[model samples]
Target: MAGFVAVIVVVDLAVHFYLWKRLVRDVTRPGWRRTAGTVVAAGLAVLVPVTVGATRGGHLWWLAWPGYVWIGLMFYLLVALVPLEVPRLALVLLWRPTSRTSEAAETLSRRQAIARGAAIVAGLTAAGTTGYGMRTALGPPRLQRVQMPLAKLPRSMDGLRLAIVSDIHLGPLARTHHVGRIVDLINSVTADIVCVVGDLVDGSVAELGKFAEPLRGIESRQGAYFVTGNHEYYSGFAPWIDEVASLGVRPLRNERVEIGGLDLAGVNDLGGAQYGDGPDFAKALGDRDPSRPVVLMAHQPVVARQAAPFGVDLQVSGHTHGGQMAPFNLVVKLQQPVVSGFGRVDGVPVFVTNGAGFWGPPLRVGAPPQVTVMDLRSS
Candidate 1:
């Protein structure tokens, strides 16, 4: 599909430039300028779509690139459709082509045309600037925190607090400074335990060396635990797991950590071998004391359905980015049983965060980034 789109774009650009060059030869005046204009316009039109597509990852971006390019073409048509009435009207009045032209009338016509052109340019500029600015300023970043009460609590730790941060895609866009900010924010939160669901890095374990400094600052009374997201699988999971552990962040791969009479289990990406074909949530729980509360950290929330039957009390996940876009919430909805926010699947409770850092575009359109603060309390 990407190949097909690339072919169409290449062909379209070729035909456009070919016709534009022909027009330049036939036209008597300002032909070179028109050719230059066409070249510049085509260049601008093509690059934006490609850039938008390359930046957006996951499956939808794979399909949207071709259609998105055409969307850019529509934006071009909008700009051209704007009427050039003022300049043409001034030409009619000043030249008076139907009658004898006066010197004063000619000067006035030229001045009016220039003034009207400047006004049109200024108005368009202001509109574009205002629209972009408003969206940027008002489009709140997708970050949220929620705490829920537990009806059945473990006696050993009745009111335990847990801070969950996930999808910190540390790469070119999520630099050291951005990560440092998150580290500071997480530290500021009052929690007994910290859990990082997954997608710690977007590219490679090499990224760890750069951002590892901030991981030192992430603090909790118990410790910080991590699980692998699908991105981790693509981004060199082995080295990343080692690097993360070196920073004191325990990467739990189909493993469990006992904390304050509660069982905390971290599973590998459902796609990985550690999960063994398809993960059996009850198996992960094993024969551990069911009387004590069980907290499972799965990168994706679909595990909730299986975990609920096993009496898993709480499951924390962060992969959806909470739809990331307004209407696309439907897509995220269809894929995951739980889209975002807090929900109870049968008997088990699930908390899916939008994530502390963004994956692509560095822009959070609909779902604001979040550091979820969950405090477990006995009923």
Candidate 2:
């Protein structure tokens, strides 16, 4: 953990330094204005780790608001400014001054103009993107009703709806009301089974437990269920496992349960292997009858490959947040086979949800927060 924190601080400091150079130093001459910008950038840089500490510490929840928002803005600013570097470089290298005196003045004026213009563009772009993402993240999750037609789905189970909710990082940013709203929305749909697919909180149960009280109110025909996500492992999986169960939500925990003649199985997150608590496909699926269609709730889409041999008809996941922040999803794709919606891995069908809450920045770009309703139907 210390090593990871060290890396984050180093990378954050480096990025902030780059942002200051491009948006501050390059745009403003050496003056108090530049000094002030430097101070602001430095403060924001330090806030990254501070906010992380506050969230993990679970004490100063209020700080998470500004800290995370700035983080989001900083990300978009970096994105917008990096590409401007290309054009700025082109101008410096290609432009030729005919006379020294006139050339020097013209060059300086042009540089200032370009720098200021680039700064303005990047600032607006970042603010707009971050603002839009914030609205999308804070608002009620987009309820997605999707059909899952399983070839072996029992005729009695036809038209069964399973509401999939994952990654509700209910800590500093998202509190009780957030969970309440989601519960209200899911209840309205009246799903056959509501699957709270892990990543329920960022802090420990003693800190964020009460915030999740709204979960007990969830209304479903069968019952609400829970499974561990990668975040759960990070937030002390054992206690969270017990806490989730207290909310009247059953934790699948590498186990299987029969519902509507369909086998519903779940495993610990694949990432848990580092803690010697990885997914046990055999325990969760091996004992199952092959003839019955099984729907697996494993937090990550990549696990589909591991569970493929067990014959998972459908795997629901939410780890990627559908690349919550745009080009970021492209990176997510490298790790998880499917970022969002239906995708096949090792010929196993996987449906990755964008999840119902934000993780770090309280903002989402191309991937809007969602609660996908898997409307199971017989193929």
Candidate 3:
């Protein structure tokens, strides 16, 4: 944890320093303007870590909102800065011609102004994008309806609606209100089965247990089933598994349950093994009727690689959050086979949700939160 914190601090400091040098220092010459710019940059640099600490400490609860917002803004600005810096670097390195003619001086000034203007535009764009992302994150999750066509699916299970909610990340930023709203929305869907694919809470059960009480009210005909996501392991997996079970939600850890003539199974998240409780696919799928189409819930999409060999009919997962923002989704794709929506691996169909909550940032740009309602059909 100390190493992780150190890395974050170093990266954040570098980004802030770059912003200060390229945008602030260049635009504001040494004067009162420069002094003010320095102060603002320093404040932002401090705010990044301070707010994060406040949130982690669970002190000054109000700081969480601004802290997370700052986090989102900083991340967006960092990405935006990459493109904006290229021209500035070129101007500094390649455009230093010795011809000091009047036209050349005027042209240099105009080009410098243009670069400054571009930096300002990039900053504003990042802020605007962050604001819009926050709105989407705070808003109710969008309902996504999908059809899961399973080969030889039981007739009794046909048209069975399964609601999938994952990656709630309930902590300082996401509290009871968010969970309450989610419960009401999921209840309204009237799903036959509701599956929560893990990463439910950021803190331990002791800290956020009360906030999660709303989950008990989730109404479903077959009850809600949960599987631990990587986040769950990070935040006391054992107790959380028990706490969720107490909430009338079933936590399937390499276990299977028969529901409506279909084999519904869930395995521990892939991260579980790092903590000595890795997913046991063979055990979860063992002793199952091969004729019965199986629906597996594994948190990360990459788990489909294992599920494919088992001939699992479908796998429901959420981790990528569809990159949770633009360009980042491209990055997420490099790690996970499917960022969001439906895809296939080894001919086994998989559905990876964008998730219903934000993680580090209280914002969702390109990948919006979702309450997925998958209607199963026999193909």
Candidate 4:
């Protein structure tokens, strides 16, 4: 990961230097401000790890300051990556504007072009940030309770209300307030069953403790079920499993449970620590009555393709976060069969929620965080 980041940094610096070189050709003395800014940005990137590590063992107040500072600095870094203004600036510097009218006109054209580029960058940045803010602020707290006919569902689940919330990356960004809102949203629906399809907590068990109480408040009729998301492996799955268990959310690891004439099966994350450790669906589900409905929970949507072969009725998953931001949706499409929302894979219905909380950057633009409320009815 460090190597990957270094590669990105190097490419970005190359672009910056390429622009700088071009500017120097046109402008003799463009001043030291741009040079200083570039140097400062690079220095900050280098210091990011050190700065983050320094927050460890710090006071709560002290910790928050660096966090906020880091957030701003990261945003600045993202802005610096815009190819519009920076590249245009470089072009202008590389080509000097002559006093001749034709040269002046050409210079004006270049200036206009650069101005347009800068405007585009500014617009995109503002729109992206605003969209993120709106999603964080005004996005629906949870899935709306809609009564779907039981006849639309598999034969066994005559009338089952399943509330699914995924990708609750509970770290510094998702504080007590956010968790409380999520709990309130979950409690709002009269779901007979609740499924959390992984990424319940972002960091360590200790980080999750801050919002565990509110998470504990999330309610369901039968029970709230959890599966391991990839984040769990990074955050220490063993301790997180115990912590969530204490909160009344049971972790289902390659196991099956019968509920209201429906079989609830779960497997660990496909790309997690217990990837192949769990009982195979075909094996664990073999004992289940095929005439009855089976709802499986896997952390990733990738498992749906496999579950379909086993005659699962509905498979719920997250782990994608619906790309978290824009254009990344294209990237996510290449990875997951079902990026977000309901889709039929093979013979089974798969529902992938965008997620209830965010991961990094604390931003959800095109994809807002969600609490999925799926009502299953007998077919």
Candidate 5:
């Protein structure tokens, strides 16, 4: 835990330093403007850690909004810095031939002005994008429908509508209202089965129990089932599992349930084993009817690799949030095989949802939040 915290701190410091060097220092400005810029940059640098600490301590709920907003800004700044710097570097390289000419001073000043202008444009773009993302994040989750055809699926279970909601991340940012809205949305879908694929809450059960109460209102024919996500372990796994159960959502800990003529199983998040008990695919599928089509719910999309060997007909997952934001999806791809949507892994169909809620920054770009309804069909 200490190491994790240290890494975050170091990264935060590095990002802030780079922003200062490129956006504040390199830009030519008056003495007062420079001083103001330095102060603002320094304050933003400190705000991230301070807000995180205070919010985790659970005292000032108000700080969470601004803190997370700052976090969003920081992320955009980091992304923007790369593109912004490239142009400046190119300008320098292009001007080398005329370095000793009388036009050098003019060229240097022109280059600085252009760099400063680019910085301002980048900042505005980030702000506009973040603002739009924030609105989308706070909006009701969009519904995504997918059809999965299984060769051995039971005729009786054909057209079985399964609703998947993942990564709600309920905490200081996502409140009871958000969960209530989510419940209403799920209920409206009239799904045959509903699955909560982990990262449901960011804080402990004791801290966020009240906020999660609305989940009890979720209605489904086969009832709501849940599995651990990486965030669950961080937020006190046992208590969350029990609390979710109390809300009438079954917590499937490496367990399978035969429902509606279909074999449904759920395993702990990939990170579960690190916290003590992990996913046991063999045990979960043991004694199952192989003739029946099986749907496995694991949080991370990468878990499909394990499901393939087990002959899972379909694997439902959501951990990538489809990159949650632009370009970040490119980064997410480096980690997970699929960011969102349907794909085939070793002949098994896998559907990864963009998730129902935001993780950090309360903003999402490129990837819109969703409550996916996957209709299973027999081929």
Candidate 6:
């Protein structure tokens, strides 16, 4: 853990230093403006680790707002500024001033003009994107409908709606009201089953269990079910297993249940491997009747490759948060086969939702928080 924190601190320093060089030094005159920018840059660099430590370790939940907001802003600033580097570089290489005093002054003036212009563009882009993302993240989750046709599903089970909710990292940013809002939205759907895929909370049940109480309000017919996500392992999976059960949601731990002729199976998150509790497809899917249409609920979409041999008709998952932020999804795809929406992974049809909550920064871009209704169709 120390090593991991050290790496994060190092990376944080590097990012802030580059940001300072571009957004501060290049944009400001050699005076108090530059000094002030240097101070703010350094302070924000320190705030990164402090915010994470205080929130995760010290449990200073209130600091989550300012801390995470700045994180989001910082991220977009880099995203915006990195692209401007190309133009900035081109200007440096193309503009050559001879050893004339007047020419040197003109060249300097033009350079400053371009630098300041680049700063303004990056600043506005980052601010606007972050603002929109904040609104999308903090506001109520959007309702998304996906029509999925299953080859082995019984015709009688067609039109069965499974409400897909995942990545509801219910800690400091997502509280009772947030869960309550999600519950209300899920209830409005009158889904047959509500699947909480994983990454439910960052903290333990003792600290954040009350925030999840709203889940009791879920109005599903067959029932609400939960499968462990990576975060559950971090937040004491043993207690969370019991907590969700107490709230009337069944925890599917490497097990399957027959529901209206459909086999609904769930497994522990892959992260649980560290705790000797990782997903066991054999335990969950080994003896299941092949004729039954199986809908596996594992946290990460990458599990499809492992589950392919099980003859799973469909898998519903949420771990990528649909990338949570734009361009970030591109990174997510490197790990997850299907970041969001329908895809065929190793012959198994998988549907991934954007999930219903935010994680670290309380901001989502390109992809908004969502409660997806997977309308199952028999083909």
Worst 10 residues of 4 by lDDT: 20-29
| lDDT tens digits by residue: candidate 6, 1-379 | 8999889989999999999988888777799999999999999998888888889722998888889999999999999999998998799778777767778787877788788888899999999999999999999999999898888888988899999999988887778998898999999998999999998888988899887898888888999999999988888999999999999999999999999889999988999999999999999999878998999999999999999999999999999999999989999999888999999999998899998888889889999999998889999
Instruction: State the lDDT of candidate 3 residue by residue for 1-379, as single tens digits.
Output: 8999999899988888988876787676579988899898888888888877766624566777877788798778878777876776666566555566666776666566766877787789889999999999989898888887887787777898899999988888888999998888899889999999989988888888999999989899998999999888878999999999999999998999998788899999988898999999889997777999899999999998887778798999998988997878888888998888999877778899888898877899988898899999987
Estimate the TM-score for candidate 4.
0.78
Regions more than 4 Å wrong, model 1? 1-143, 273-283
TM-score attained by model 3: 0.92
* Each model's lDDT: 0.67, 0.89, 0.86, 0.69, 0.86, 0.90
Write down the RMSD of all candidates, one decimal each: 8.9, 1.4, 2.5, 4.9, 2.3, 1.5
For each candidate, what TM-score against the reference? 0.68, 0.96, 0.92, 0.78, 0.93, 0.96
Writing each residue's lDDT as its tens digit, candidate 5 over 1-379 gives 8999899889888888888877887785659877888898888888888888777624466888998998987788777768767777777667643445757676767677767887888788889888999999999999988888888887877898999999988988888988998889899989989999999988887789999999998899988999999988888899989999999999999999988678889999878788887999898877777887788999998887877778898888998988988879999988888888988877767889999898768899989999998888887
Q: Which candidate is the best by lDDT?
A: 6
Write the number of the candidate with greater TM-score, choosing between 1 and 6.
6
**Model 4 lDDT, full chain set:** 0.69
User: Model 5 misses residue 207 by how many Å?
Assistant: 0.9
Off by over 4 Å in 5: 57-59, 92-108
Residue 180 lDDT, candidate 3, scale 0-100: 90
Better-scoring candidate (TM-score), 3 or 5: 5
Q: How would the candidate models be sorted by lDDT, starting from the highest?
A: 6, 2, 3, 5, 4, 1
| Model 1, residue pairs in steric clash | 141-368, 142-367, 142-368, 142-369, 143-368, 143-369, 143-370
For lDDT, candidate 3 versus 5, the one ahead is 3
**Distance from true position, residue 208, model 2, in Å?**
0.9
Candidate 4: clashing pairs of residues: 22-94, 23-93, 23-94, 150-377, 150-378, 151-378
lDDT of 2 by residue, 1-379 (tens): 8999789989998999999888888788889999999999999998998897876736788898999999999999989999988998898778777788799877877787788889999999999999999999999998998988899988888999999999988888889999999998899898999888878888888888888899889899898888898888777889888888888899998999998688889999877899999999999999778889988999888889899998889999888898999979989888888999999999999998899998989999999989988889897
Query: Could you tell me how far off, in angstroms, the CA of residue 246 lies in candidate 4 after the best superposition?
Result: 1.1
- Per-residue lDDT of model 1, residues 1-379, tens digit only: 8998788687666644543332232222356676676776576556545655554333233434344433333333233323443554555465543335566665555555554454455446534543442343223233355656665576556668888888887765455776787777788876688899988786666544666568977888999998888877766778888888988888777778888678899877676654343354555787787787778999899878767767887899999888754445688888897778887777678889888776544444456777788878776
User: Residue 180 error for model 1, in Å?
Assistant: 0.6
